[model samples]
Target: MKNFNWTNIRLFLIVGVAVFLYSFSGIRNEGRKIKQAEVVFVDNENFITKKDVNKLLKQNFDTVTGIKKVQLDLNKVEKSIDTNPMVDKAEVYATIDGKLTAIVVQKKPVARIFSGSKSYYLDYKGNEMPLSESETARVPLVSGSIDRTDKKRLSELLNYIYDDDFLKKNITGLAVMPWGDIMMDIRGYDFEVVFGKPINIDRKFKNYKAFLQDAIKDTLTENYKTINLKFTQQVVGTKK
Candidate 1:
């Protein structure tokens, strides 16, 4: 009975020692220093580069390398990258093998707005996006007396034009009048388009298409000075 009791006590001590050693090893691994970081853009666009993300990450940690894995505030690191105007979203994580990774998504600009001398891009979200030194987006340009409140409508209008291949290839510029009216310019055509208010977009576009198809079929596309779609149910073209 004495020998059996001793064996049970020895087994318990052995198990306890093994558990302590395992936990110690895990703790030590958690303290391992990060050796490198990699930034990946989901869209693969260079509007925001890896160097830019590295700078943003450094803003939080000075230098991310050589820091213990458990000491990094990943949420703060992600938030830092989110502050960039070009970034739409960002996610950051640390690997067990001492590598840090950040995945970034960038905003998409639909039109470049030129209000007076101030120029900026209007993104798909209807927000102003600053131009990048990396690359210029090949989007339509908007000019004239643009009201701040009209941004959402303008963005929608630009999106509609961009989605249609015919309109996207022909329409190059838009102008907002002081009285809240809109105008458009077509590529390779010497005519102005009276777009009017941004409502009834589908109907207006359909009417314009009918007019355009007839004008092209008749070989009189350049015979017009202005095409008006503001009138109800019809597109009015004024001969030059």
Candidate 2:
């Protein structure tokens, strides 16, 4: 009897079994109908819901319910879901055990815009998001002849405000002047902060903060009518 190479033989057997099982599973699942479909959002604070996903799926893949797993085109299904303006990313896949899964991520809105002609949210990526009646996002409100052209600098300002806890809580309104100066309205104070353009934006904010720090000690914030940040390295306050 020839001495057997047990290692080689064992490897071959393992590979052969794996191949056989894969082929068998594929064959067995081919005619089996898709049992379930699950849709999940990547984040807890989401604009889109499972019901919306279901509606989209039904609209795009009407025959998916009774179709065999092998017949489903996951790529096409994903593309359909991704068409929604609210969706930032979408992934669709099917498992051999007769279940299809979809994972979706919704766009994040940083600011809301009330332009003359229309109203929408400017997402972090500067894309337009239709204002939601179901839920309202707590973000800075921008008004005054704004359009998509202002999205970049607008996004930057919103980001700065949101990043700072004090600014996020106190600043409620933002307005753009005709000559391109940006104005912000504080929640409690009646005055508006004139933030001219975005030049030296960080320094302007620093100066504003310094002024506030000093004003709080003497209660001067209430008397100031306007805090102009257009001048170099200063926050010029006008009396009421």
TM-score of each: 0.82, 0.86
Candidate lDDT (C-alpha), each: 0.88, 0.83
lDDT value, residue 123 of candidate 1: 83
Per-residue alpha-carbon lDDT of candidate 1 for residues 43-160, written as tens digits (9 for 90 to 100) = 9567777888899988867688999988888999899899999999999998879999999999988889998789998888888899999989878899888883266777788889
Checking candidate 1 for backbone clashes, the offending pairs are none
lDDT of 2: 0.83
Tell me, by lDDT, which candidate is best.
Answer: 1
List RMSD in Å for every model shown.
4.5, 2.6
Question: Each model's number of backbone clashes?
Answer: 0, 0
